[model samples]
Target: MTAPTPGTDGPSIRPRTAQHYSVAPVLDTPEGYVAPGMPGVPVTGYDPGTPTPHRRKPRRRTGLALLLAPLAALLAGLAYGCAPLRAADSLGWLTIAQAGLVSLPLGLLGGRNRLLPPLGALLSAGALLLGQLIQQLRLVHADTTTPRTLLQHTLTSWRADLRPLDLAFYAIALTGGFLLTRRTATRT
Candidate 1:
C-alpha cells in the first residue's frame, strides 16, 4: 500500500512521501549549470548591481554663426568705403558695396562646412583683392578722377565677369551642405 522511490541503481526499499526531502543527482553537481551565486549575471558580462560607462558625441556648427560671417564682411566694406563718403565723397558707398560682396561668399562658406569655412572666407577675400586690382587698373588707364566713379564704372564694365566666381561659390556651398548633412545623420 505504498509507492517505492525511483532509483537508477535499484528500487528504494522505502516509500517516496516518507522521507523529509531529497535532491536529484543532476542538481547536486557544479558541472554544466551555474549555482546562482556566481560572479556576474547569466547573460551580461557585467553585474546588475554595478553601473556601466557612458559615451558622448561631438558638437556640430550653428546656422546663425554661418550667417554672421557675411554680415561682418558687409560691415567691413562699409567701414572702408564710407570713409570718403564721410568726407562728402561718393566713393565710400562703392567701398561699402565691395566689402559687402566679399562678406556674402565668406558667410555662405561658413554655413557649409566647419573644416572648409576658413578656406571659403579666404577665397572670398582673394576675390575682393582681384576686384581692387581691376578698379586700380581702370584709374591708371583712363586717368579716372575718383575711386567711387572708377569703382562704379569697373562694376558696369565687368558685370558678367563675376559669373565664374559665382559658380565656384555655389559649388563649395553645395558640397559643404551635403557633407554636413551626412555627418549629422551618422552621429545620430
Candidate 2:
C-alpha cells in the first residue's frame, strides 16, 4: 500500500450522511385518532376546531384536615385543663405560653392550606371552652359539689378563668402558626 498522508485515515474510515424522513400532514377526523396500545377513549390534542375545557385538580388532605382538626382541639383542651392541676399558681402568664404549645402541632399537622387558620381559631376557642367545662366537672367530682352549684359557679366565673389576655395570646399563636407553616410549605 502507498504511504498514508499526514493525519489521514485508511479507506475503511468514511464520513456519514444524515438520513431524512418525509413529513406527513396530520389529518383531523370526526372521530379522533387514538394512540396505539393506550386503553379507553382517545384523548385529543389542542385544536382550534375543539372547545377547550376548564379542569380543576381534586383537593387532597381534606380527610386529613377533618381528622386532625378535632384531634388538635381535644389536645389543646386537655393541655389547658391539665396545666393548672400540675401547678395551679405556677401557670400564670405561662398559660399564655400554652397557646403556642397548642397551636404549633395544629399548624404543623394541618399544613399551610387556606382552610387551616380559621379552623385553628375555631378549634382553639372550642378547646378553651372544653377546658373550662373539664375544670368545672373535675372540681364538682372531687369536692362533692352540687352539679347545679358548680355549673352556676363556672358560668359566672369562666371569664376570670379564661382571661381576655389569654384569648389574645391564643389568637396571636394561631396567626403565628398559620404564617410559619405557610412559609415552611413554600420553602420546600
Candidate 3:
C-alpha cells in the first residue's frame, strides 16, 4: 500500500479489494478511512476508537513550597546553633545532638524528595525521647531525691517541652499535606 500524502487526511493503507481504489488516498485514520458502519471495513474506513492527536499538558511543581524548604532547614540549623553543646556534661551535649538530629529530617523533607518526611519524624521522636532522658539526668544531678522523684521531675519537664516541638512537626506535616492537595486539585 502506498502511504498517504503528507497533511491531507487520507488512507495510507491500500485495500485488498478493487472497490476502494476509486476513493482518494487521504483517509489515513479509522475515522477517515472507513465510513461509519461499512461492511468488511473498507480500506478507506476511518476507525472511530483512535485517539485524537493532542499536545500534552505541562508538569506542575510546588515552586513556593520548594523555595521554603531551605528556610525550614535553616530554622532547624538555628536550633542546633542555640543548643548548649559546650557544657561540661555529656548529657548536655547529648541533648544538643538529639535536637540537631531531629531537625535534619525537617530540613530534608523541606527539599524535593520522598524519604525526608519519614526520616524527619523518626529523628524528631528519637530526639524528643533523648531530650527527656537528658532532662531526667539533669534532675537527678540537681536533687537529693529518690529515683521515683527524679523520674517524676523528668516526666514533668518532658510534658512541658515536648508538646511545643511535637506541635511544630504537626504543623509541618499539615502544611506539606495542604500544599500537595492544592497542587492536585489545580491539576485536575
Candidate 3: TM-score? 0.28
Please report the TM-score between candidate 2 and the true structure: 0.48
Q: Per-residue CA lDDT of candidate 3, range 6-31, in tens?
A: 45875446554565656677645755
Order of the predicted models by TM-score, top scorer first: 2, 1, 3
Q: How accurate is candidate 1 locally (lDDT)?
A: 0.46
**Judged by lDDT, which candidate is best?**
2
Models 1 onward score TM values of 0.31, 0.48, 0.28
Error (Å) of candidate 1 at residue 112 is 11
Per-residue alpha-carbon lDDT of model 2 for 65-140, expressed as tens digits? 5576677668767766666665643433443343444455545555556766566556656766676566656655
| Backbone clash count, each prediction separately | 1, 0, 18
Across 69-184, the per-residue lDDT of candidate 1 in tens digits comes to 44554454344333432342233223324434444434433333444444434434543445334443443448567878776676665464445654444444344433433333
After superposition, the stretches of candidate 3 with alpha carbons farther than 4 Å from their true spots are 1-120, 161-166, 169-188
- Whole-model Cα lDDT of every candidate shown, in order: 0.46, 0.57, 0.47
lDDT order of candidates, top first: 2, 3, 1
Residue 55's lDDT within candidate 3 is 73
TM-score of 1: 0.31
Clashes of 2: 0
